[model samples]
Target: IVIGSGDLAAGIADQLRAHPDIGYDVVGIVPETPDPEEGAVSLGEVEDLPRLVREHRVSDILFVGAGHPDRVLGTLLVKLADAPVTIRVLTDLESITLSQGVAEEFLNLPMLRFERRNLVHLRPWLKRVADFLAAAALLVVTFPVQAVLIVAGLLARPALAWEERHDYRGYPHRIPLFHDPGTGWRGALFRALPPLRYLPSLWPILTGALSFVGPYPEEPDENRAMEDWNLILTRLKPGVLDVTSIADHPWVPFRDPAGLNMYYLQHWSIGLDLQIVLKESLRVWDKEEGESRHG
Candidate 1:
């Protein structure tokens, strides 16, 4: 059954009607509309998906809506989990490739079967091991520099800045970082040291609330306003560093921030995490070198 009644859904129906050899019937659209296209039936609202599936003897479902998948695809899956139906999701090419969805080209139109799977399900323990080790090592190595910066900041400013941010699971936690409360050059100098800003983030990683490499933390308000796909990202631990900063360099190709995080979620592995860490370290070193030479 076609799950939408918009232009894309109508277009797909038109193409399917033209291709007789494809051997598939055009089922009615869902989320009952007052104005369905010519010769198309309107099934009940999305909440009645299961009943419609049974009544129509639906063998397949094509979700062609441009709405967020959490509301569109998620609602359908919850009701039709046990139903025998082949579901195809229409999404962008990047999401299709990252998700490992089966790709098809019909009349030069890209089609992908949307079967969502947790990419890191099999290696949670391994990821925890890596997070613990990396967090511990970073804390040890950076403690002296952090101490010096803390002392200096305390002497110049009344208090250090502590930002309250939400993690992947929407849990609130305070992260310590240097913020210039417009206290002149001393506060500016404190903010210039990137290592000092990330020292307190090690606590979350050590305590198992975060990973050494994962999605960046979002503010509570920002997290609430995110789209369905971005909300999925909050399921993974937030990291101190993100791929976006590294990818932002002139030499590195620009990537969509959300797409890059989604890519990491779908293709996560211990080895991939290590590679990202190494690249991030190098990027930081190059940045520091350029700053020293220029500043």
Candidate 2:
């Protein structure tokens, strides 16, 4: 559905409706004026918006025209706060992404989103399920190596160390790891096998407290949860591997965790997660191989 109907609404609606491949099905419109153009699927005037949205089950809402806060726009935003619909406004303005709103192209027209929804989405759950299975499989394959490490830790007398991290919703997560192997061939071997440090995290994945790919967990910090993007990251469990840490080109200058994490959340899918996992394994192998050759 679209708000502020006129030429802007009609043009955008027609373009999206014409292109089936674009995946936008404009079901109806909500003009600010009572008199919308003739023959358009005008649901009703501005006052009737909330009712129309709930009645028609609108998944997305596009507000036409310049995004200056008009009385109608201001009221509509507050009213629709609890509604589970994605909202965007058509704008040619420069991007103000990465903070409160995100800018993106909607059928070639620049659109701005004023809100970030931490709502329950099926894709996130699908991601969790996929991570859970991958973790299970890795644990099974590396059982022998894990057993050997456990035995070594036992004999070395500094078996395990517990570290504190925060998980979803600022819940405390106690992570267990084999203590430092020390400055010897044993330590070199441990460094060569970076994944050894993360084997304990596999169980959390099985328990749905971690993912195979997502935003890397930050150490306990009260301020992190208060930031806009960081607040969004709390929507899901931290991951065993940060996607860009493995998939991003080494020469790229942009490496801010907030920006990279926001990008990951915006474009995540099961296929993307699998691709990241494959790249992560290969990258780790390459690193270990290069280090071993030099060391």
Candidate 3:
């Protein structure tokens, strides 16, 4: 639907009608003054844009007519803020250059495009959504085992206390380590079940405190390999699993040397996370097979 007033409105409508190959079918016009002589049927008034869009099932709306002066365009845009339609508003080239807008030249005129919220860029957001879904699934799979361990750990408080750490953006967070204090054979036993030990981390990932990939959170006062590298790494949400953690012995004191952690951060993506997980899984499978052969 085109929203405009006067002969200029007729000219814009004529241009749109002649250019059917441009991939738009102008159903009608929404004129400020009801015109019986107008070629396109009047849809409605400018104030009724949202309702008219819904009633006419409008997928494209343009503000090219003189009735839509730039001063009132902002208010009109706000009215259709949530409308599921592509909005094109005629604006000066300088305005498009100064502000973030999708502009295109048509008929020697600049038109700025506004799209629905759902169609925005999906790069980093894609990873965040994936992390949430993956963490939720992990919780569903590990909940039963975690419940039993929680009961036992409660019986033995000395198993390990919650460790405090700093996550992305320097936000302080606490995580379960399930660290056995090396006081008894029971400690050794719990340490042997590595998967059970880190199962608690899925809850944090689901809560947005962590991710399935990225640097592990460091202790509050732990020394960093390079202050700059450590500062840069904190930009990402801390994860329970990282290549450094996966490659090292499960029982060894975990350390995120700057070089390796930086590499993971530099090339970070969903694909890198999946590759690390696959590599670790294969390592465990190989270890188990070797043990079985020896036994």
Candidate 4:
């Protein structure tokens, strides 16, 4: 069961609904009215979250809400401390890293289930919805800013700004503006407004070349070099944003990278994916914002 009736809640419900082995059911409870979507039903207000869990025999509960996820999550934890319901919390807030105090109380109930979560029955459908809304919102908000940045960068550093250069074999590679490089404008625009990076990959995602959330795609040669490690990371499609990319970890050894991805895959869930995506979006956005300011 998932609590809260916001997008995150809906996304989680979508994941649970997709997992066949889990045999999961979702109950969305909001302070106001709720909409019944897929296998989920409205369970009234936040006060009724525990009751819904009990009634539905829910083995797991994911918290997907808007505004101050930690605060909302803390409240739910306090309320359900003695309710015998395992809970998961989702958030985009970067301030309050999950505290050990809270994690101890909840016993870290919302475990990440990277791979298994993908096996979920409703995941494909739910991910499509979440991707659509997220990409649409991003495009709407950033397109203009991106266009301005592109024009400015093209005029200022028409030679493909030194920093914007892509390096292959550790050598700087720049495509000229005089000749239309199909990827030039769009690439510069995305690099300037990194939030739209996902826009380019949306089609690949829909076509199964990508997963809703996973490792960022490595360059082909780099990908091939890690034949051994590929055993680990190759199982999933590259996500536009992911743990390694978000964490800004350099030297992503072979495949395991200190077994982070392995652990991530083992404990991945829709909530975890939400957390990672949000974190990555911030990192990417900030990097671009910094570049824009400097440029």
TM-score each candidate.
Answer: 0.45, 0.48, 0.39, 0.33
lDDT winner between 2 and 3, please give it. Answer: 2
lDDT of 2 by residue, 225-270 (tens): 3655456677777666665663244222124454455556655677
If the candidates were sorted by their lDDT against the true structure, best first, what order would they fall in?
2, 1, 3, 4
RMSD of 2: 15.6
lDDT, candidate 3, at 128: 74
User: Model 4 over residues 66-88: C-alpha lDDT tens digits?
Assistant: 55456556666887777777766
RMSD of each: 13.8, 15.6, 20.7, 17.3
**What value of lDDT does candidate 3 attain over all alpha carbons?**
0.60
Q: Pick the candidate with the highest TM-score.
A: 2
Collision count for each candidate, in order? 0, 0, 0, 11
The whole-model lDDT of each prediction reads 0.64, 0.65, 0.60, 0.50
Q: lDDT at 288 for candidate 1?
A: 63
**Candidate 2 collision pairs:** none
Counting only residues 3 or more apart in sequence or on different chains, how many pairs clash (N, Cα, C under 3 Å) in candidate 2?
Answer: 0
What would the TM-score be for candidate 3 when compared with the true structure?
0.39
Model 1 Cα lDDT, one tens digit per residue, 1-295: 7776555566566657556567778767774234545335566677777898898888988876666445766776788899988887766343434345567787896555557675433255677888899889988998887677667778776446777555554466666666555546654554354455557778878998766676654445643567556656665566655555434332221244554565555566777787777777666667866775797
Positional deviation of residue 37's Cα in model 4 after best superposition, in angstroms: 59
